[model samples]
Target chain A: MDDKLPGTLPGSRRPGRGPRQAQEIYRATLELLGGGGYDALTVEAVAARSGVNKTTIYRWWPDKDALLGAAIVQSSLLRFDVPDTGTLRGDLSGLVHRLVGLMTGEATSGVVVAALAAVAGRPSLAWLAREFVTDRLAGERAVFDRAVERGELSGSVDPALVLDLLAGAVWSRVMLRQAPVPDDFADEVVKVVLEGCAVRA
Target chain B: MDDKLPGTLPGSRRPGRGPRQAQEIYRATLELLGGGGYDALTVEAVAARSGVNKTTIYRWWPDKDALLGAAIVQSSLLRFDVPDTGTLRGDLSGLVHRLVGLMTGEATSGVVVAALAAVAGRPSLAWLAREFVTDRLAGERAVFDRAVERGELSGSVDPALVLDLLAGAVWSRVMLRQAPVPDDFADEVVKVVLEGCAVRA
Candidate 1:
């Protein structure tokens, strides 16, 4: 099951411990982050929660930020398969809908909220936020690339700007405004953006 | 300067204290929010910093969240004039550029970051974030209203979504990715969005 998961951090598994143990550590870290937030998260608390030895955990990750960063990267909450729906509109619509679910889902939203809180509050963890966004953007770039290849979008259309506008609207609604996302909102956004980016004859 | 500022919370001025005293308290609150974040902020700290009695603050606010909410509403950092450039493109371009500056500005970014941290981490303060966004959106609605009046945009266009996308793109770059905002980025976004919302001839 773990092997099927996308983008497991390389070398996360140590000499003696199996991938199962690493998963346990990551799980504990996320729970703590969701429950108490970044300031209250500590290596010792993770060790206690995971039942992993403190010394062993410390040997693997240098500090709380490193540990939290690893957990965030490896966590299922952050992972999503890039959509391939044969058109930019279809792909973006599907992606944005899923993003709304991921960000607002009860099972995952706490961790999302906690991670964002850490990103905003902790300067040391800013790199982690950047890496997470960059990695996600890179993965989503495939959709735009395919659209350009299909002539649905201009080659000159900036994928980063397109994706940012798409995702930022969702983030603003979910994270900043904490408002209910109206049905059809995602489709409306995708339509406008695609129209905005359509290659003029 | 105080009188010139927009949206000072009503009834904030007490019998003995002037608007000057209220400004001092708000200033001190923002400073503490910037310096130590929401978790470390306290009524005691504000009183000490602003030279206002904790009793007076408590009499007005009733709690930390209330005090913080008032401070955020009254802070000059959150205030901006609604641009009226006669066209949707010009107005949105100016608004997005100002947003990028406001979110990334050295004098204001810390308070912005701290307020976001509070919003994300503290559920009780979520209302504060919602209120702030709603108020800002209400203020900017005039831009879209003018565009519709001039037939520069469709009457059917959703102002909330447009504003969210524009501001969200900036926030995603400044607050999430912490990436540098390119010189032409704002205008590009505005152009795309306006095209997307253009009135169908």
Candidate 2:
């Protein structure tokens, strides 16, 4: 998520004023995002809620969008590290189950979806997409690229599209809220796409 | 995609209007969409561009958004059909490859991505995702469900999410313009995803 708020004041690197105040502001920001949708997330409210001056908040984030995005990225709620158990299937299966756990559990997939839908409206949010997408792709892409380098699969395949296509489907379902990313669905996604079951006639 | 446009006079079906007129209006709608993206795809301009009467255009589509949708779905451009080839790999591989083709060729991927981005601002278009999503899923779900019943795989898997995760990844890439869907990517998408490779481990 890109920071939706644009006009941010850069923060203080001074020793005494940093940790406690920044933590409070970030907490309030997350609380606001949780309680209200992304549109309702306000720097003014974060300042008030955290008892931090508005200047302090602005100093940390460039804009409301950026603040919100930073809050989300920093969030322990949806944070994850992709697992690597040697094979793509094993790794992705665990990842998918974890994903379902997040989407269905405390992370509040529906709210994130709505927030993202809301973000999708703003052109400025492209920055947010880039930030999160680049960061998130790191773990998934790492495993696939490693496998290719090991000659585990064909060198001709572009892992980028492979990752995007599978992940895209999951994101669409979550954001569109059309269906749940079911328990076994992710495994099926990894399986059919990788094995090339189609015996070319 | 559903014909958000009914192609009838406001109150009733006009028996008099023929396919040529319908084709012309649809053509105008696409041209307008091509020229100015979704925001400028207006009924009056479509009428003016195609030389069809404005009333005729409105008679079919209730609004520009509906007509814009109609233009996208009705265009013979990027048309695709499911090929059974009596195998899951063939079907899935073909689908992935075709989706990649459709997205990469449109160069309009950015337009569609931006359009999806833009739709976030309009509540009217947000609901329209289901309309477009359902049409795309209908054909694939039938094939998937049949495969399950045939003992090709476990019946417990949710066919919907399978499609969602698969389709979502492809679209996320296209909409984000992060990468192009390459030809060989389809093989990985088809293979690893279908055989329940992850679960087998």
Please provide, for model 1 over A1-201, each residue's C-alpha lDDT reduced to its tens digit, 9 standing for 90 to 100: 243543333434434433457788988999999998886799999999999999888877778877787788776666778889887788999899988988898878898899988898777677887767767877898988888787777777888888779889999988888888999989988877867522232
lDDT of 2 by residue, A33-129 (tens): 7566566778899888989888877776757776676655555555677888887667766666666665556546544554455455454565665
The C-alpha stretches of model 1 lying farther than 4 A from their native spots are A1-20, A197-201, B1-20, B196-201
The lDDT per prediction is: 0.79, 0.60
B-chain TM-score for every candidate: 0.86, 0.77
Docking quality (DockQ) of candidate 1: 0.47
Best by TM-score: 1
TM-score of 2: 0.63
lDDT (10s digit) by residue, model 2, range B13-70: 3344334676777677665555565667778888888898888777766688766665
- Candidate 1, residue A37: Cα displacement in angstroms equals 0.2
Tell me model 2's lDDT, rounded to 2 decimals.
0.60
State the weakest 10-residue window (summed lDDT) of model 2 chain A: A6-15
lDDT (Cα, tens digit) per residue for candidate 1, span B1-201: 233444434334434333457778888998899888987789999999999999988887777777788788766766778888876777888999888877878878888899998898877777887777767877898987787777667778788888778888898888888888999988888877866522233
